[model samples]
Target: MDFGANWKHYDQAIIPLPPDHPITARTLSGIPGPGTLRIGSSGWTRKEYTNTLYPKGVSTANQLTEYGRIFQCVELNATHYKIYSPAEVQKWVEKVKNKDFLFCPKYPQSISHHSSLLNATDETNAFLDGIRAFGNQLGPVFLQLGEQFSPARKATLFKYLESLPEDIDFFVEVRHADWYNNPTELREYFKTLREMCIGAVITDTPGRRDCLHMGLTTPDVFLRFVTKGNHPADLKRLLEWKPRLDAWTAAGLERIFFFLHVHEGEHEAAFYKEVKEVFGIATQETQMSLF
Candidate 1:
C-alpha cells in the first residue's frame, strides 16, 4: 500500500490493451460507415510530409504516394496558415483514396488569431465551402481557436457554428487556459457546443487533465495527440493515457480520431505501432510514419 507514492507511475505496468481485444463491430462498420472512425497525423503539407516520408531525396509526389500507402488521414494545417485556393484542395482530394483517407482542416489564423469573436463574418464559411471538393471525405472541419478568451468570442463562435450545415462535422479546440480555469463558464460555453452538436477537440498536452470532463454535455469527441517527445518515458505516458481514451469510447460518444505529432515521426512509428496494438487497431502495417 504505497499510498504516498507518485500515482503517475502506478499504471506503468498496466497493459493498455486487453489480450482479448478485437476491433469493434462499429469500427468495422465505419471502415466505410460514418460515425466515430478515423485516426491519423497532423499537417502533411510539402515540408512536414516530405521530411517525414522522405528524409533524404524523397520526391514530393513520391512522398504523397507513400503517405497514401500509409496514413488514412492528415490534419490540413496549411489551411489555417494560408488561404488555399479551391483548386489546391480539389487536387489534394483527387490524389488519395485507397486507404480511405480524409482531411480535417484547421480554421484560418486570420479568423482565429487576429479578430474578435463577433467579427467572424463569412470568411470561415467561405473557406470551408472553397474546399467542398473533398466532399464527405472532408471529415471534421476543426475550429482551432487560439489564445483568445472572452464571452464575446464564445458567442460569435457559437453563431458561426450554427451557420454551418448539420452534415458538416465541427470540432472546437481552445488553447487558452482561461476557459479551463473557470469550469462553470467553460461548461456553459460547452453547452452551446452541445446544442449545436459540435465535437470538442481533446488535446493531450503537458501539464493538463487532457480528456474532456464534461462529456455528458457534448455529442462527439475529436482528439489531437501532440506528443512533445518520443522517448521511452513518453511512450509510458502515452500507454497510461490510452485507458482514459478507452473510457471515452466506452461512453458511447459519436467519434474519435487521433493524430500523432512528435519530434521524430520515424522512431515514433514503433511507439504508434504499440499504441495500435494496445488499442486493438490490428492492421500490422505501421502506416503513420515513413522509416
Candidate 2:
C-alpha cells in the first residue's frame, strides 16, 4: 500500500491552548513560518488537546474529525502498549477519510520487553493487522524496545522480525546500553537493517535527569526530543543535534521526521512559543488596528 518514508514538517505546527487568545511567543518560537503545514502531536485521541478543536460533548467520531483539522499526521503511542480491535481502528480511519494525514504506530510493549518477548505472538499480529488495515495512510511502524534488553533476547527478536512482511517499513528503537557496548555488534545491527531497507528510529532525549539518550545511528532518523517546561536552554542544545542530522542528510538519507515533545510548559502556549524560536521556524501574530 505504498508504505515508505514520506517527510512531513511535524515540528512546525502549533498546539493551540483554549484560554490563550493569541498563542504565547515562547511556545511557537521554533517554528519556521506561517505557511508550512505540519503533521503534529504524538497522540490523536487525546481529549485535553483535541476537545477544543471539536464541538463540545460530541461523539468520538465527531471529535476526531474536528481534531483532524489542525495536524496532518500523529504518532500513535496508545497501540504500543494496549490491545485494540481491528473494528475500532477502522472506525478511526473512517473518521478521517480523504485526508493527507498519516499514522505512525508504535509496536506493542509485549514484543519489546524481553520478559514477555516470547509470548508476544498474539500482540504483534494484532498490531501489524491494525497498521495494514489503515492501508495507504499508515506511516512506518516503530518497534520501540525499552532500555532493559539482553543478548539472549536478540535471537527471538530476529526470528519474529523475519516472519513479518518485507514491504512494510519497520523501524527499531534500541535503548539498552548493551546494544552500544560493542562497536562491531552495533555496526552489524545497523548493516542488517540497511540491507533489509528498514529505517532505524533514532532517539535523543534531554540531557536533564530522567530522560533517555540514544544518539543518531543512520541518515533516515526519527528524533524524539523530550522537553521539560520552557527551558530556554533547550533551544541551544537542539542546534548541537543539527550537525548530526546534517551529516545524515549528506550521506544520502532520503527523509527524516523530527518529533518534538514538550512536557514542562506552564501551559501549552508557553511551550509553543519557545519551540518556534529555538528551531528557527516562522512565527505568526495578529495586531489590532483602530481608525
Candidate 3:
C-alpha cells in the first residue's frame, strides 16, 4: 500500500473518465450478462478497529464474523506473507460461509518475489491448495509483481500464469514502469492477459500515476485503492471512479473487487458505505451482529 505513500502532494482534482483500450472494449462489447461487484478493505482485524469494526472487547478470532456482517469482501493480505493450511483457511471461510462474501487472496511473496514467478512449483501449489478451501467464497487471486519485476520477465511470468488452474480466477499487477512506458509492451500486456482470460489489477495511489493504467484485460476488475485518511481528496478521488466503473459495466465488465486501504478503523465503515452508495451498492452498515 506504501507504493504511493511518501511526499505528501497529489492532484486533488478529479481524474477524468478514461477511454477504454481497443482490446478491452472489443472483448467487453461481446459480453451480454450483467456484472457483479464486491467492495471491502484489505483486512478486517486491525487493532484500530477496536470499538468501530469490532466491539470494544471482541476477540480477534471473531473479527471476521463481525466484518462479514458489514462488507461483501476482503483483500486477503495475510496470504501474501505465508501460506496457511487448508484447515486454517477453512476456519476463516466458515466465519463468513452464509454471507455473500469473497476472500480475494494475494499470491505469496515466495512465488512472486523470491522465485520471481520462476521454478516455484511447490510454493505455488501450496498456496493454491490452501486457498482452494475457500470454495465458492474465493475471489480472484492476484499476482503482484514487485517493482523490480519488469516486462523482460514476461516469458516466465506468462508461463506461470498459464499454468494456473482455470477453475480459479487470477489477476496480475505490474509495478515496473517498463510495462507502461513502451506503448507496444502496454498493448501486448493487455492482449496477452485477455487471450489467457486473466484480469488486470488497477492500482490507484497518488505517488504513482502510471499504476492507474485504466485497461481491463477481462470482464472483471480488481482495484487496489490507497487512501489518505480523512483527506478531502480521498472521497473526491473515489467518486471519480464511479463513472469509470459505470463505463466499464456498459462495455462488458462482469465483476469488480474494489479494495480500500484506509488506516482509521473507526471511520472505515463510514467511508466504505459512502463510496458504495456512490456506486449504488447497498451497505450492511445497519446489520447489528457483532461476532
Name the best candidate (by lDDT).
Answer: 3
Which scores greater on TM-score, model 2 or model 3? 3
Count of clashing residue pairs in every prediction: 1, 23, 0
lDDT string for model 1 (1-291, tens) is: 111123344334332322211212222222222235466776554464454444567766556556665666777777887767788887777667553677888888888777644566677667877768677678788877755555546767777778778877778877566676676767676667767777667655433442333343343457665553445555665676566555545644455677766655555556556666666674645443313
Which one wins by lDDT: 1 or 3? 3
Tens digits of per-residue lDDT for model 2, 61-173? 57556656555666788786775677877877888754677777877776777444676677777777777877787777777766666444667666666777887777777
Extract clashing residue pairs from model 3: none
By summed lDDT, the worst window of 10 consecutive residues in model 2 runs over: 1-10
Return the lDDT, model 2, position 265: 27
Name the candidate that leads on TM-score.
3
Which consecutive 10 residues in model 3 have the weakest lDDT in total? 282-291
Ranking by lDDT: 3, 1, 2
Q: Candidate 1, clashing residue pairs?
A: 36-255
Instruction: Residues 138-222, candidate 3: write the lDDT tens digits.
Output: 8899889999998898888888888889899999999999998888989988898998899888988877777788888878889
**Model 2 — TM-score against the truth?**
0.70
* Ranked candidates (TM-score, high to low): 3, 1, 2
Root-mean-square deviation of Cα positions for candidate 1 versus the true structure, in angstroms? 7.5
